[model samples]
Target: MPGPVPAPPAAGPREVLALAVPALGALVVEPLFLLTDTAIVGALGTESLAGLGVASAVLSTLVGLFVVLAYGTTASVARRLGAGELRRALAVGVDGCWLALGTGLVVAVVGALATPTVVAAFGVADGVAAEARTYLAVSMAGVPAMLLVLAATGVLRGLQDTRTPLVVAAVGFTWNAVLSLVLVHGPGPLPALGIAGSAWGTVVAQSTMALWLVVLVVRGARRHDAPLRPHGAGVLAAARGGVPLLLRTVTLRGALLATVAVAATTGAPSLAAHQVVFTCWTFGAFALDALAIAAQALTGRSLGAGDAEGTRATTRLMVRWGVGGGAVLGGLVAAASPVLPWLFSDSADVRAGITAGLLVVGATAPLAGYVFVLDGVLIGAGDGAYLARAGVLALLAYAPLLAVVPLAGLRGTVGLVLLWVAFAGGYMAARAVTLGLRARSDGWLVLGAG
Candidate 1:
C-alpha cells in the first residue's frame, strides 16, 4: 500500500565535489598532525619513535572506535536537515557533543589508570614500554578534548560545512608543531621534555580545537534556536544511535591493531617500517574517506528529502569518484615510495621494508576506495546495523591471513610487504565483497515518511 517511488533527483559531479573537496582537505589535515608528530618524534632516536608507534596505535584505536561520534552525528543531523528540521538537527548535534564529553571523560580516567598495563600489552622492549607509558599518560589528559573535536567535526560535516574544520585543523597542527619543537628541545627557559613534549603538544592542540569548536557550536545554536544544554532523552538517543557504528568501528580498529601486532612479531625494524607505511595508508585513506563523507552527507540528505532514487544515484557517483581518486593516490604513493620512508627514518632496514610495503598499498588502493565509499553510503542511509554485521564478518575473513604471516617465516622487507598485502589487499577485498553485495540490494534504501 505504498505509493510509487518518486523519480530520483538530478545530482552531478559538481554536487559531489562540493561536499568532497573540502572534506578531503579536512580529513587529510587530521592525519598530518600525527605525521608531524611522527617526524618530530623520530629525531629523538628509533626507540623513542618506536615507543611513539606503540602509544599512537593505542590512541588511534581509541579514537577510531569513538569515530562513531562523527559518523552517527553526520548521518542523523543531515537527515534531519534534509527533512527541514533545522532546530532538531542542531539539537541532535548538541546531544552528540554531550555524549562525546561523557564518553571522553570515562575514557580519559580509564586510559590514565591503565596506561602502564596497556603499553605493556604491546610486548615491546622495556625502554619502549617506558616511553610509551609516558606518552600514553600525557595523551590521556587530552582524551576529552579529542572526543569533543570528533563530535563537533561530525556536527559541522552534517551541516555541510567542511571548510571550517579544515581551517581549525590547520591552525591546531601548526600550534602543535611549534609547541612540540620548542618543548622537546628546550629552545627557551622551558626545560627539555623529549618524547613527553609531543604528548603535551598534542594535548594543547586538542584542547584549543575543542574550545574553538565549542564556541562555533554555541554561536550556531543561538542562530538556529537550538538548545545548547543536554537533554537526557536526546543524549540517550544519540548514544543508542551510535551503537551499531561503535561495533563497526571496533571491528575495523581491531583489524588494524591486529595488523600492528603481527608487524610487531616481525621485529622492531619491521614494526617501525609498518608505522611509516601505515601512516601513508592512513593519509591516503582520508582521500577515499572524503568521497565517503560526501556519500554520507548526500545520501542522508537525499533520503531525508524523501528521494530514494537520488540516494541511489548519489551512491553510484561516489563509488566512481572513490575508485578514481584512489587510483591517483595509489600512483602517487608508488612514485613517492623511494623517498617517503627516508623522511621518517634513516635506517636501511626500515626504509627497505617501507619501500616494499608502499607498493602493496599502492596496488590495493582501488579496493580500499571501493570499501571506504560503500561504507559511507551505507552509513548515510542509516544502515549501521548491517555495517556492524558486515564488519565483523570481514574481520573474521581477514584474521586467518594475519595469523598465517608469522608462521610463514616471512621477515624483513618480504615479511613487511606480505603483511601489508594481507591487510591492505586481503582485508580490504573482504570488506569490498560484503559492502558491494549490500549496495546492490534494495533492502537498505528505506526512508521513513517525511
Candidate 2:
C-alpha cells in the first residue's frame, strides 16, 4: 500500500513570480505572433486584413480546442510529481504528446479539406473570402506542429519548469517575425507570396518550435530515465482526460466566435475595431494568465503532496496577485487606449470603436483577473468536469445578450462597444461567479484522485 503523501513547501509570492513571470513571457509570445501578423497583413489592404481576421478566428478556435494538451498534462503530471512519482509524471507528458500529435493531424486534414466551406461561413466579400481561404488552407498545415508545441510546453510546465518554454517561445516568435517580414515583402530574388507568404512563415516557425520541443522532451526523458515511446493505454487515458477540457474550451471559443459574428454584422470598421480590442484584451490577459498558471502548478503540487492547507494558501496569494496585477494592467491599457488602435489601423472609425471597447475591457480587468486565476486553481485540482459544465452554463447565460446586440440595432462604434461590454463583461462575469463559487468550496480538493 502507498504511504502518506508528504507535504510540499508552502509557496509564497516569490515562488508565484518565479513560475508566473516566465509563463507570462511565453503566453505573451503567442498574441504577439497574431499582432505581428495583423500589422503586416493590414498593409496588404483592408480586404486582405479582413481575410486574415477571418482566417485567424478559425485557426484560434481549432487550436483553442486542443488547449487540453497543455492544461490536462500539466495537472496530471504535476499531481504525480507532487506525489514523488517523477517517472509517472514524465510518462503522463509523453502520452499527452502522442495524443496531441494524433488529434492535431486529424484537425489539420479536416480543416484543410474544408477550408473554403469554413471561410465561406463568415460571409466575407469574394476578394476577402479568397484571401481567407488561401491563408486558412496554408495555416492548417501547421496545426500539427502547433499542437505539438502546446503539448511539449505543457510537459515542461508540469515538470515545474517554465523558463525553457519561454526561451523556446522567444526564439520561435523572433523567427516568425523575421521570416514573415522577408516572405511577405519578398526581398531581392524572392517573390512576394502575399497572404500565403505570411501563412507559410507561421508554418515554418511552428515546425521549428515543435521540433525543438521534441528534442527537449526526449533529452529530459533520457536524463530522468522516463520512457519516450507512446504507450497505447496511457495515450488513451491522456486523450480521455482531455475530453472535459475540450468541451470547456469549445464553449469558450464558441462564445468568442459568436461575438465576432455579431461584430461582423455591425460592419467592417466595427469588425476591425473588435479585432484590435480583442487582441489587446488577449494581450492584457497574459499577466492574469501568468498568475493562473502559477496557481495551477502550485495548487497541483500541493494537492499531490496532500498539503491541503498549502493549496489554500497558494490560492489566496495568487488571487491577491491576480487582482492587483489586473488593476495595474488595466490602468496601462486605459492610458494607451488612445494610441494603441493607431498601431493596428488608420481608419478613424476603427480607431474610435477600439477606444470605446478598450475602456470597457480596462474597467473589467479585475473581474477577468479573478476569473482566470480561479480557472487555473480548479484546473490544477483536476476539476475538469465541473469546469466543463460551468462553461456551458456561462455560455448559455451570455448567448441571449450577444444575440440581442444585432437585433437591437446597435451598430458602428456603439454596437462595437456594446458587443464587448456584453461579451467580456457579461460572459466573464458569469464565469467569475461560477469559478468563484467553486473555489470557495471544498468540492475541488480531490488531489491525486484525478
Candidate 3:
C-alpha cells in the first residue's frame, strides 16, 4: 500500500487562526448579554437586580447543559465535510437543528411552568422571589431560540465557518442592550415593563439571531439538496450522540459546584474573593476555548479525510498553541492580580484573599492549557465515552483534595488559596493526566466519516 496517506499538508498558524479568531469573538461575546442585563436591571432597584441574578443563573445552567448540541454537531458535520460528503454533512446538521428545536420547546414548556417553584427554591425574599418568577416566566420564551442558536452555530463551525456566528452574536448583543435599556425604563411611548421588559428584550434578540441562523442553514440545505424536515431516526441519533457529551458536561459542572460549596465554608470574605477569582478564571477559559474550538473542527475534518497522521500532527500543534496561550494568560493574570482586586472590591481582606487565589491560578494556567486543548481534540474525535468516563475519574481525584480543606481548618485567605490550589492545581492536573494519556494513544483517533 502506498505510504500511509502523507500527513495532510501541514496545518499551520493560518489554518488555526482562521477558526480560532472568530471563535474567540463568539465565545467572548456570549457573556456580554448577562453583563448588559445586570447593568440595565440594576438601575431598576435592589430587588430587581437580585431577581435578575437568580433568573440569569438558571438560564445559564440550562444553556450550558445543552452545549453538546453545538459540540456534537460540530464533530459530526465536520467529519462528513472532511469526507467530501457535503450534502450528507448539511443533512446531519439539519437533523441536529431539528433535535435542538424539539428539545428547546420541551425545556421551555417545563421551565415556564416551573418558574415559580424554581424561584421559590432559590429561597429569596418575597419581593425578590416574585420578581424572579416574573423574569423567568418571560425569559422562558427565549430558551428555544437560545438552543437553536447553539445548534446552528455548531453547524456553521462544522462547515469550517465561524465568522457568521460572530457577526450574528455581535448584532444580537447590540440589539439586546439597546432594546433592554429602552423597554426596562420605557424611554418613550413604550410602557415600562420593569424586569420583565429586560427578559423580553433578550427574548426578542435571541429569537432574531436564531431566525437568522435558521435562514442561513436553510439556504445551505437548499443548495445541497439536504432534507429540512425532521427525520425520526436521524433526530434520535443526534440526541443519542449528545448524551455522552451531556454526561461529560454534567460531571465537569459537578466538580465546579463542589468547588463552590467548599469555598462557601471559608467565610464571607473568602467566598467573595473566590467569586471574583472564579469569574476571572472563567473569562480566561473562554479565551483558551477559542483554540480548543478550532482544534475540534480541524481534528474532525482531518480524521474524516482519513488522515490520522495529519490529525496527530495538528493536535500537537494545537497543544503547543494552548501552552503558549495559557502561559501568556497566566502571566497577564499574575501581573494584574495586585491591581485586579481593586476593580472588584474595596475591602482589604477580600482583596488579600483574591490576590492569594489568583497567584495559584496563575501558576496553573499552563497546565489548564494542556488540559483544555486535549479536551477539544478528543471532543473533535467524537470520543465522548472516554471523556465522560475520564470526567468522573478526574472529579474523583479532586474530591479528596477538596475534602482536605475542611479537615485542615483552612480559613479566610488561607482557605481561598488552598481551594484554588486544589482546583487549578489538583483538579486540573487530574484532567491533564487523563486527557494527556488519551491523546498520546491512538485509541481516540478513529478515522473515517461515520
- Candidate maximizing lDDT: 3
Clashing pairs in 3: none
Q: Which digits, one per residue and each the tens of the lDDT, describe model 2 over residues 1-450?
A: 112242364787778888899999998888788889999888899988999999998887766788789998888877887888777777788888988899889989999999999888889899999999999989988999999999988888877788889999999999999988888989899999999999999999999999998888877677678898999999999887789988998888889879988999998999999988987898788789888888887788789878788888888888888888888888888899999888988899999999999989999998898889999999888899999999999999999989887899788999998899898799999999899999999999886635
lDDT of 3 by residue, 1-450 (tens): 001122243478888998899999999999999999999999999999999989988998988899999999999988887878778888999999999999999999999999988988989999999889999999888999999999999999888888999999999999999999998999768799999999999999999999999999989888878898988998999999899999999988899999999999999999999999999999999989999999888998888899888888999999999999999999999999999999999999999999888888888999999898999999989999999999999999999999998888888998889899999999999999999999999899888889
lDDT of every predicted structure (CA atoms): 0.86, 0.87, 0.91
TM-score of 1: 0.87
lDDT by residue (tens digit), candidate 1, 56-152? 9889888878989999888887777677666777888899999999999999999999999998888999999988999999999999999999999
Cα TM-score per model: 0.87, 0.88, 0.97
Runs of candidate 3 exceeding 4 Å displacement: 1-10
Model 2's lDDT to the true fold? 0.87
Clashing pairs in 2: none
Task: State the local distance difference test value for candidate 1.
Answer: 0.86
Q: Model 1, poorest ten-residue lDDT window? A: 1-10
User: Candidates sorted by lDDT, descending order?
Assistant: 3, 2, 1
Candidate with top TM-score is: 3
Candidate 2 Cα outliers beyond 4 Å, as residue runs: 1-9, 37-51, 125-130, 181-186, 189-194, 263-273, 336-356, 403-419
Where model 1 places Cα greater than 4 Å from the true spot, the runs are 1-10, 38-51, 123-131, 185-187, 190-197, 263-276, 334-356, 403-419, 448-450
Residue 450 accuracy (lDDT) in model 1: 29
lDDT value, residue 152 of candidate 3? 96
